[model samples]
Every structure is written in structure tokens, then in C-alpha cells.
Target: MKKVNYLDKFLLKVFILFVFFGSLYANDHPYIIVLGTAQDGGSPHAACKKDCCEELWDNRFLHKKVSSIAIVNPKDKKFWIIDATPDFPEQLDFLEKKTGFSLAGIFITHAHMGHYTGLLHLGREVMGSKNVPVFVMKKMKKFIESNGPWSQLVELKNIALKELSNEQFISLSTNLYIKPILVPHRDEFSETVGYQIKSKKSLIFIPDIDKWSKWSYDIRDVVQKNDYNLLDGTFYNINELPGRDMSKIPHPFIVETMELIEKDKNKVFFIHLNHTNPALKQNSLEHKNILKKGFNITKFGQKFHL
Candidate 1:
């Protein structure tokens, strides 16, 4: 070996330190946790006098507001929320406790009340955040800009809207990317979308869809392409909601979804459950059957390392 000088030894030590820190930073992966799994109105919905709502009121059950998730990037100590549901305050508190107090951004999938209405909390009356970035679709961007309470948030500079394109990827870090996929749903105010979140491990989220068969796209194809699929499971059966017309409110029933995904084992996890759906109960027959069939019913506080 050649003789090493003091300057050469110093340079080698600095280079080694740089390489070690770089590897440590590169190895950190983002994590996600499901905060809620109910539909837009959520379990124990407003004006709902059903047994489910009663149970929640009496503290027998603790159903959350709606389906939403928290994505934590440990490397940056940043937290991202997907879908700002009515239960945002509680969700934020939960997130704050689980991960430190650092909210990076909020990604909205659509203009539905359950999905994006919680942006109100960021307004002057609440956190009064200065230019909190909100990632949304083009139409949703316009909708928020023109709407009343949402528009006020924009005018006050509480939230800065960032338009997202369908099927286009938004990179949060070298190891994490989120792509939005357009889905067919009630477009009374704005279009609907599902997200394909790619980390070292990818996960698909399709919270609300009109009907899988009616859509021009193939849901199965999307599931086959992703590592984990968190699909729409709004109802357990067609007649789940007693008084409502099942045809008007379209979603893939748990039974039908199970049948459709029977062949593809260990990939599907059903979410976005309605209050009427018995699958929400931990000990329910529906829940047991789903687990037995290699399907999972998404529960609040469930974490997935990505």
C-alpha cells in the first residue's frame, strides 16, 4: 500500500462520513395509517337516529367521521393527510400524538362533503394557517376558489391550491410518489378520483366509485398492478340501506367484491364502509368471512410501512 499523508487521511474520513449519512437518509421510507373507514356521512351520521348512531352517542361505539389516511415522511418529519373529512380535528390530534406536529400538505381526491369539507378548520377561525398547500384536481381547484367557505380560505391565504393531473405522479421524496386516477362517481360539484400511492411498496385507494362494471376502466387491472388495494366497500349487500334506492347509490357490495376478487388472494382490503354495513362490527360474520377469504376490512389506526 502507498503511504498515506495526514491530509489524505482527513479527506478519507470526511468522505466516509458523507457516505454513511447518505445511506441512512436514503433508507428512510414513508409510512401511512388509516384514520377512518366510514363513508362520506360517516357512521353515526348527522340526522341519523339509527342504532349505530345511538350506540356511538352512548359511548358504546366510537366510529369516526369518514374514510381518510395520514401519510408520514419520517425523513422530513412531515405529515400529509389524504381526504379532510369532518373528523379532521380529532384526526389531526391523533396524528399529532402519533407523529410530531408537522403538517406538510393535504391531498383532496374530490369535492365531496366528506372528502374536502374539513379545509374549514385551516381557516382564520381555527388554525389560521398561512398558505397551507392543498393538492387538488383542476375542477376541484376551481370549485374551492369559487365556493363560499372554501373560497374564504383561499382569499385569506389560509390554503394555497395546487392543481393535480389525472394519472400524473406527484413526488414527495425520492422513495414516495402519489398518482391520481379519475373514477366515475356522482359529479354534482366535481369529478371523483382515486390515488395510487407509490413508496418502496405501492398502495391503491379507491374510496368511492359509482359501479366497477359501469366504469370504462377495469378495476381488476388496477388492483393487479398494485401491491395493496384499498377498495370501496360501502355496503355488505344490495339491500343494505333499507329505505334508499340501491340503484341510485352505487358501490361495490362486500359480497360481490369478494366474489369478484376471489381468485386474487392476499391483495384486496375493503374500506369506505357505510353505517348499515355489518362488516364494520369486529365480531360480525361478514368481518370473519372477509378475513377468512384473505380480504381485510380496514380499521381506524391501522398502519402500513411503505
Candidate 2:
């Protein structure tokens, strides 16, 4: 056996340090990525001949998917999706390619059509994903387990449901945590929740709600407390949809929400835009007004690092 020299020992130490710090430098931060910003029906909604849907029909590039987001932990090479929207397949592929991270789990907000319907893609007929952890509130868990098609996914072991209680913190990684905050909404099937994601910088995500007034907490205070906020902008105002009684389907109009948290607009990004929302069009006057007011609208591929 030959003894190692001091020069060889020093070289070995340098190699080890290079590997350690290089790994840290490459994957030290986690982030939230905006997948889609449209409402449940998505942009260019079905069977509608309105100009909002008309314009997008010819311009496929401008089409938008339903609202959803993903929290990515690069260090672990894994990520979790907030909602499994109708655009799940595309969003999942985008996340995997963009961040090089495999999906670890999913957190559903409600049993709404867009929010959880994409779970169908995980069924045996589709991805056939085995034991994918799906976090949800009690009602949502029951709804999925008891309902057809969705229930089949559970029975086939495509996804494993994990029930969450209101306001309970779920730690995702060493520096990342998420808490489900229940909010008032049309709970026909399950409860609606907004997630508070905590890391080096925190964020509040509420894609759907009846109205800010109905929530227990003040929207102003939540905006001030979080570094980033993605709240409901389902419609620009009550007038967006003509003939239909807006009261029948209540959501905080962007105008109404702006009045409440105008001061902290910089931290806010309005999302889940209805197809008829003028703000959905980048060149529309409504879009410019939101920018002028120092508020933002979520765009596909927008990223917030933690």
C-alpha cells in the first residue's frame, strides 16, 4: 500500500468542496411558478361566440388555461401543484421541463370543476400514476372518494388522499411551509381555501372566492403580510357578464378588490380571469389600468423565488 502525499490530499479536499458548494449553488432556492391564469372555464370558453372567445380562437398562442400554480423545491428535485386544473397535462410537462423536477404531490383547493377535475388524467386510463399524494380538506377528500370517476382513481391507487384541517401548517421542505386558509365560496361540493406558502419569502394564493367581504380575514391585511399574492380576478366587474345575475355566482370583482387593497397593489397579482374579462387581453384598457394602478395580472411562466 502506498501513502497519499499532502498535494494529493489537498486536491481531494478541493474536489469535495467543489461538489458540495456547486450543488448548493445550483439548487439552493425553491420557487412558485404560475401555470395558468384563466378561470375554471378557461379562456376562449366553450361554445361562446363573444369577441372575447372569438379573438382567441384564431390566436391559439394567446389561449389561456385554467388557474393553477406549482411550488418547486429544486434542492430535492421535486415539486407540488396547488390545483390540478384542466390544463394539468401541459402544466405538468412544463414544470418538469422547466425545473427538472418530478412531481411529489398535489394540494387541491376545492372540488370545483377546474381545480380538481384534472385528477382524471392520473387515472388508470391515463398516466396511471401510483400513490401520488393528494392533499385536501375533509369535504374535498370525501367528495373525491365518493364520486364516480374520481372515486375510481382512489380505488385504482392512482392518488392517495391526505385530509387537511383548516389553518393547519404543512411543512413541505426544510425552509418551505404551506397553510390552508378557508374562505367563503359556493361550497356545493367542498370548501374553498387559499394557501399561504412560507419560505424565505411568503405568498398568498386565492384563485376563487365569493368575495373578500365574506372571508374571515381582511384582504388588505393579507396583502400587507405576504411578499406575493395571487387572488381571484374571476371577473373585472359585475358588468363583465351581461344578462346573467352576477350575484348568482359571486366572486370578488377586480374593481372591488382593488378598492380594498389598493395601497399594497405591488405585492398582488390578480388571476383566475374569466374569458370575458377585458383585463385578460394585454392590450385592453382594463389591463393598462391595472398596471397603472400598480397591480399585476399573472402571466404564464411567471416565477417567484423563495
Candidate 3:
């Protein structure tokens, strides 16, 4: 039998203390998890024969869901999702399996199909969730309450709409806050807004903004204030969609956004990529360029401590 030394005992105690504090720190802070990264139509878009999506049709593993993210509090066993997308069912299941937490609530960015349409899952025919608090802006609240299918969700008590005022911070949990900042977009049904989530650190999400110049607030200032920024990357550049008018479906191209914030490129993660966007291909030159330039591309399941 080997005899244990005083030094071994001291090392054992140090290791135990490290493990104890690590667990406590993880539980004390909330984090953001990326659920999906595709645009509203999703990857391998319907009725498309483009080269970018053609290979994805046969590759089930390559499919990307609509853009969405989840915030999780391990301490309380609660989590919240931003932008209940068409992929809500799978996203919800992923969160449940990943964290085993109850959904705290959902936050919607706008009335866009990819943003708010997933509330349908909580209706009578599906989960039939009871009073699932859905946070939204003023026009968004009215849009849901007044619409047919969405109104039915409200009437059946599947969801409880909570209106959020622009730039006002709302408390989600201890040391956790969320603020909505209105942005310029094609607000056909409701106004669009970006969310700023604060925990140990802050993160900014602007997945569908039309263009940075159109907004009153400076994009560079916003990027600097937040630890992480997931901005719109619907197209790699203005020439992505040929024959189709790019002006009508405007978004700050990846190149344009990159040029805007040269210094803080490390803090930015471009997301909500369209099928035609070459950056969606991991090995493509555009994707490589993004990383080479100190910027990042958001991927499904990426976790960031907040």
C-alpha cells in the first residue's frame, strides 16, 4: 500500500474547491445558445434549384433551421427563446434536451414569418401551452390580437401577450435584463426591433435589420456597447440575387457590415444567412474571408456566456 503525503492532501483539497466554485459560477450566470442560423425560408429553400441549395436537398444533416436563439438560466432551470421561428418545435425540444429547463417565455422581434409564426405550436392542436408569455412591441401586440390564426391563439389562452416599449429594459431573472431597440425594416404588419440581453455581459441581436444607415442609432456604437453582436447577414453582398431586385428585400450585406466596424469585427457574428449566400458554405472563400477578417459566423448550438 502506498502512503499519501501532506502535499497530495493539499492538492486534493485545491481540486475539490476548483470544481465546487466552477459549478457555482456556471449556475450563477445565464448564457445564450444559438438554436438555428438560416434565414426565414430556411436552407434548401422550397422550389429552388440553385447550386447553393441543390446539394443540401439530399443531405439531411446540412439543413439549417430559421434564425432563433435561447437564453438559459441553469440555476432556476428556466430558459427563454428569442424569435419563435417556424422551427420552434425542434428548437424547443433541443433546449429541453440540452438544459432540461422549463421555458420561461418567448420574445418576438417582429411580425415576420420567421420571427413570430412559431407561436402556432402553442395553440390547442399542438402543445396547447397555458399562458406562454410572448413579449412584443406595441404594433406587434395588436397585429397578433387582431389577426385570424394568431388571434385564435390569444382567445384560447395559448399565449399571453406582453408589450415592450422601445429601449426600455425588462427584468427576466436575477441580474438578467432585456431591452428592445426599434430598427428600420419592412414593417408590413408590425415594427421591427433588436434585443439587447444583459447578464454577466451584454449581447445585441439584430437578425433582420434592413440597413444600418436607415437606423437612427449608430451601428458601431451599438456593437461597442455589447460584448457580442449577431447582426443580419442575409446576403454576402448586393450581387447575391441576380435577376431579382435586391433593393426591395434590403439587408446590410456582410461586406457592408464588415466595412462599417473594422475594429470590433471580433465581437460581431453575422447570422440569418440566405440559401444563396456563399458564406453559408463552410469551405467557401467568402466564409473563409469573414473569419480571416476577425469576424465570425454564427452556427447552430454555439453557446456564449452572458
Candidate 4:
């Protein structure tokens, strides 16, 4: 009878341990880490030593490259990068050190310099990577295939292009998938797209739409459909760049977006800020106002579990 009692207690302890570990594993979700929050040229913009830029130049205030994200698969030890910004070398280094894996592939959003220029680093003159898969839209693939310097990458087979179709879901794993959604933006060379990254527990991404009202689809509908939304926040207010004509450049200002999505604060996190935008300052009034609205502002090195 004493031997039976001992066996029962041991089984109970093993069962409890199994239950606890199962719960922990179930709660563990896949996540993406933000590498940068600044716009194309990045904070401390070129040729201008304004107070903000000058202050940022100090070692203490240095920021990462422009808006980019890394989707990490901890279990498989594989990861993918979205948007190869101007700071690709540094961003790749950071990912390599943090996740300890070379990039699996890179996804491009458009033909903009900040969006795809970093591919140069993968060429013979730089990393000399061989056959790094680069996913792009149809037009974007042609743009790179036809363009001079980029075409060289294709010829030398440094990067291979994978054409992405809109609204089609690409499964990254059993529980994670990515879908490309068309967004209205400057399509000078290629169409622009915002990715819908779906994990078991969350969904989010950078959707740089031209104007919410102008698009055939409604922005609110998209937000309602996703558990998390990291849309554009390129400017704090409409008049952010006073000297330059705002009409020439377009993005939904933070204030305007807040007004549009005031009711659905739970799903919004603003990203892709311009260098001139005061929201970059963590202690600024603009930042406080945004936080008060229950909306988050993205920062480099910040990770979100899906």
C-alpha cells in the first residue's frame, strides 16, 4: 500500500509539470521585431543639421535604419526580412547577432530607394551573397529585372525574384501566413502593397496607403479584420514640412489617422515616421497625445509576439 501511494504522488507531480509546460508553449506566439521607425532617409536626414537632427547625431540618440521588420521563427532558426532599407548591413548584422541566422529572404514593398536599395549590399562588391531569394510584386520584379544596377544582381544570380500575387496567402508555417494587399500609392515603376502577416495570435504590418478616402477599399474595414494594425504615421500633422509643398508628398498624418480611427484604438500602432516629425521624440507632446489615445508608436528593437 505504501508503494502504491508513492507511485500516485509521482504521477501527480509529472502530470502537473506537463500541464504547466503545455500552457507555456501554447502561449508562446511568433513575433516580428521593429528595426527602425524613421522614414526613407532615416532620422538625422542628409544635408540638414537642424536642432532635432543635430541632437540625434549624438551617440546617445543614434537611431536604426528606416522602417523595417524581421519575422522570426525561433523554433526553426529561420527568419525573413521585410523591406531592405538603406541600413541593410547594420540591420542584417543586428538580426544575425540577435537571432543567430543569416536572412532567409527579403520582401520588397515597392521600387522606392528606401524600400529596395539595400539589395546592393547583397551584390559582389558587398556581402557577395549567392542566390538570396527576394520576393516582389510583378511590376517590381520587372523593374529590377530591367534596371541597370539591379539587373546586374539578377544576371549574376546574387538574388532570385519570387513574384507575389495580391490577395493570395503564402504560408510561412503551419500557424503563420503572409498576404499582400494592394494599396494606393505612387506606382511610378511598380505597384505598392501592404502585407498582412498572420500568426496564431496576432496580425499586423505597415500599410502605406495614399489616402484612406481615395482607396477603393476602406481602411477601417481592414483594421477591423486584423487583431493589430501598424499602419502609416509618416507625419504628425498635415503641415509638418512647412517649406515643402505637402501636396507633392502624401501620407496619412498621425492626427488625421487618430481622428479616423478614434473609436478603434485597440488595434492601431503608428509607424514609418519622417525625420522632421516631432513624434520621434519619446517625450514630445505629440507622443504623449498619441499614447493618451491608446495608440502605440513603434520603436527600434521593440518586439511584438504574434
The most accurate candidate by lDDT is: 3
Who is ahead in TM-score, 2 or 3?
3
Candidate 3: Cα lDDT at 245: 96
**How far off is residue 216 in model 4, in Å?**
2.6
Q: Rate the local accuracy (lDDT) of all candidates.
A: 0.86, 0.92, 0.93, 0.83
Model 1 alpha-carbon miss at residue 171, Å: 0.8
| Cα lDDT of model 1 by residue, 1-306, tens digit | 345687789899999999999877654668788988999888877787877577776663576559998888888888899999998999999898988758899999888888999999999999999998999998899999998989999999999999999999999877789988899998888888998898888898889998888777777777778788889999999877888899888888888877776456577888888887888878789889889988888878887778
**lDDT tens digits, residues 1-306, model 3?**
135687788899999999999889876689999998989989989988989998899999999999999989887889999999999999999999989888989999999889989999999999999999999999999999998899998999999999999999999988999999999999999999999999879999999988999999999998888899999999999889999999999999999999999678899998899999999989999999999999999999999899
Model 3: residues with Cα > 4 Å off, grouped in runs = 1-8
Per-residue lDDT of 135-167 in model 4, one digit per residue for the tens? 999999999999989999999999999999997
lDDT of 2 by residue, 134-187 (tens): 999999999999989899999999999998889989899898999999999999
What is the clash count for each candidate, in the order shown?
0, 0, 1, 0
RMSD to the hidden true structure, all candidates: 5.9, 5.7, 2.0, 2.9
Compare candidates 2 and 4 on TM-score and give the better one. 2
Error of 2 at 217 (Å): 0.1
Pairs that clash in candidate 4: none
lDDT of 3: 0.93
For candidate 1, give the lDDT of residue 54.
70
Q: How many clashing pairs in candidate 1?
A: 0
CA lDDT, candidate 2, residue 228: 97
How well does candidate 4 score on lDDT at residue 57?
A: 73
